[model samples]
Target: MNQMALDKAAVLAEALPYIRQFSGKTVVIKYGGAAMAAADLKAAVMQDIALMKYVGMHPVVVHGGGPEVSSMARQMGIEPRFVDGLRVTDAETMAIAQMVLVGKTNREIVTHLCAQGVKAVGLSGQDAGLIRAVPHRHRSARTGEEVDLGFVGDVAAVDTAVLETLTTAGYVPVIAPIGLGPEGQPYNINADTVAGAIAAALKAEKLVLLTDVEGVRADRDDPGSLLSRVTVQEIREWMADGRLEGGMIPKLQCCITALEAGVNRVHIIDGRVPHSLLLEIFTHEGVGTMVVK
Candidate 1:
């Protein structure tokens, strides 16, 4: 065969073992960042997910719509608020969040996946009582005082049966991050927390988060300092040394939670890179940081 054909064969050969290993295993993916925003990239990711299902690997998606929610809020003349990297959702904001996440974002994702010839089911944490939540308060970073983030929920429990049933029936479940509180109020939960909680509930084989930045870096300022493999201890150390701050703290915390809950591995990868999901899964040179215990 020619050189081009040889290279193609080599790529397929390399993926064979991984394909066999992950066949029938569940991979819960948290879809966010640039991949979710761009049209072409979003289509590519949906295709990647559809391909995973076609290849016998069960894939579930938990998505976030922060940017869309903010855009909608602005259109409605409500300035979005944040406290400690979590969105402060008042009742009105919560309504907007629900409409954005469930009506807009979830349907868009499902449509893309369907265009790729897969059965995509759109859902929310509200469906089938999938994600049960309670009010959450975080310490103020500046004052060290507890602050209630209105309508923001901390996951209390996850019902895994809905997910299992969908996967069993060869469906890709795309979930939104809105959950129900004790008073039957719809709360806006963080997508990362919802993904981690669902992965833990199902004891999934992998938890993959697609974000804007490259993987974890040894130095935050250096773009070339991406770490391919990271330990939970290293993440904790970074947190202690103030290296992991802002949005990254919660992401790393979710990885820690998934790892502790018996997940085989957790990955944080750059969603901006086209076909990154396939590269990370099928190749030895993963385009992400794999967090291991």
Candidate 2:
């Protein structure tokens, strides 16, 4: 056989397993980090989602606009603030968050998907009450007293009906992380938590988080120390050993939560690389960490 024929055969062989595993199954993707800023990376991410939809996989996109929101807020003279890794959202901050997330970021993703021949609809957590939240308990870093962070919320519930309807109608649902709390206030949610909650509610087959790093590494400073596969027990051991700390702590927690809640697998991949999602999902040699229950 010629090289062309060999390449075609290899491609089919590589995709067969993933096609079988994911066909008719839901996959929730938490899209953020470098991928959100770089135009090329954004296009690649959209293409990956479109291909998954085309191949019979239901994809629900949960995206974060933290960096974007921060930039916008800065331009508007609003200083960004954080507490315990969660954004400190006041009423003004919530307004900016909604504008950046629902107005700008959400529409951009939807447009990209549509350009790739994938029908997509942008939505906020407030839309159709898809995600409901309550004021997240914030502990003071010094006193450990519960401090109220106005409009910052933890996802109390996820209604997957809208997502299911969109997916069934051959549309991809791109969700912005802004939920309505019980008091009729809009709250900003952490994107990872939103994705995990949605995936669990839908019993998704996979939850993929696109980030700047290759995957979870044993040594935070060592690029080649990526862990290919991890389990819940192993993660607990890593945390106990002080290996998982800082930003990775919350990301790993999200993955573990999703896995425990019936998600088949959770992947943390490098969004900077072109076609990273395809390489991770379709090839034997994946490009990220796979967390399993």
Candidate 3:
């Protein structure tokens, strides 16, 4: 055999144990950021999810389209607003979010999965009461005053019936992070929080978040400071010390939430890297920061 063929065999051998271990287990993937933006990276992510399905791992995708929504809002003459990395969703923004997430983003993901020969169904939190939502009010960190974030929601409960049915019937469920409230009103929920809630509801084996950056870093500016593994306590300390900020704060907070809700592990991976999902799941040396209980 050629040297390259031998190397391929070794790689497959390395993945064997992981495949066996994760077979029949559930993984909730938070798909967004650079992976969703770039065509090549998007293709790689779809391929990874397809491979996971073929190997008997049930992968549920929860997606975010904040950039798309923001762009659309701007086009409609509305300036996008944010509070602590969460979108400040007014009524108009909520409508835009739903339209973008459910109408465009969800269908695109389903089409991509279909191209990979995986059966996928696109859905939103509004479907089948998947995510029951309540109003999410943010407290100003500086003023310590309560702030109203219109149409922004937090997950009150998750009914896993639809998700379970889809996974059991050999379908990958691609979910948009828009929740339904008591009055049947739609609310914009952060994708990271939605992913965590779904993972907790399903008691998933892993909750993997794909981001532009590598992972949790001791120093945000220093690439060499990436922490390959972290515990909940460490993440809390980092947040308390203001070491983690911006979008990273929500990502890590959701990781801690998932861990507390009995998820086995949470991973934050760099989606810019090709086949990063496979690298993180199958290799001994993963390309991400793994959060453990």
Candidates 1 and 2 compared: the better one by TM-score is 1
lDDT of each: 0.92, 0.89, 0.94
Summarize candidate 3's per-residue lDDT along 1-293 as a digit string, tens digits: 99999999999999999999999999999999999999999999999999999999999999999999999999999999877677888888999999999999999999999999999999999999999999997897668898888999999999999999999999999999999999999999999999999999999999999999998898898999999999999888988897877899889888988899999989999999999999999999999799998
* Every model: Cα RMSD to truth: 1.0, 1.7, 0.9
Highest lDDT among the candidates is held by which one? 3
lDDT of 1 by residue, 134-164 (tens): 9987889889999988899989999988999
What overall lDDT, based on C-alpha atoms, would model 2 receive against the true structure? 0.89
Q: Give per-residue CA lDDT, model 2, range 134-244, as digits (tens).
A: 988878755789887888988999888888888999999999999999978999988988898988899899899998888988788898888898888988998888776
TM-score for each model: 0.98, 0.95, 0.98
Worst 10 residues of 1 by lDDT: 241-250
- Winner by lDDT between candidate 3 and candidate 1: 3
TM-score of 1: 0.98
Give stretches of model 1 more than 4 Å off. Answer: none
Write the number of the candidate with greater lDDT, choosing between 1 and 2.
Answer: 1
